[model samples]
Target: MKEEVTQNYLEKVKAQIAKLQSFSIVRIPREENIEADYLSKLAIVKEGIIPPNAPIRYLELPSIFALDVQVQAIDYSNSWTGPIVDYITNGTLPDDNVKARQLKI
Candidate 1:
């Protein structure tokens, strides 16, 4: 029974690690990991029912896109695109007839 429980725990851990394709696992000793010990003591308090399709949201660092920034600069010009930009940014209709028609299309 004990061996079966250990095998089940190991399988669950393996499945979780498999989801993270590019990750480095660091084994920290209990004596050196004070934060882990402290965090384990904090009990989870559920206030409301979680949705059936609730996503397992995980923290991810924002990706740097130098090419996308450069493309945006090349694609749009403030001089001619101010009205369209205003409409997009503030959800307001452009005063100019030509720009307004273009936006609608």
Candidate 2:
């Protein structure tokens, strides 16, 4: 039943997208979908804390922990040589760092 509902909803969405002259659809594997899925989960977790009305599930903690650890590992690896390599290859620190600092200001 749930699968049928989901397929119906997706078909509706596809029809709507087809009506839009500039829209395109590209299907990718579930493995390629993980980053987007993780980012969406993180947003839900952040929003849940702010509104304080939703029921928080223990299951969410593992996803949050996995994302946190992945971020920390990237930060650690980047701390060693990311900046130097970026400057050498691109001639400056990445625009992401600049944009982040600007947001804090």
lDDT of 1 by residue, 36-79 (tens): 55444332425454434434343463222112332344445456
Per-model TM-score versus the true fold: 0.28, 0.26
Model 2 lDDT tens row, 29-83: 6578865555555667754453333333457433322432223334433474665
Best by lDDT: 1
Model 2: residues with Cα > 4 Å off, grouped in runs: 24-51, 55-105
Q: Which candidate comes out best when scored by TM-score?
A: 1
lDDT score at residue 7, model 2, on the 0-100 scale: 79
Q: Which ten residues in a row have the lowest lDDT in candidate 1?
A: 61-70
The RMSD (Cα, Å) of candidate 1 is: 16.6
Query: Model 2 Cα displacement at 67 (Å)?
Result: 39
Cα error, residue 92 of model 2, in Å, equals 44
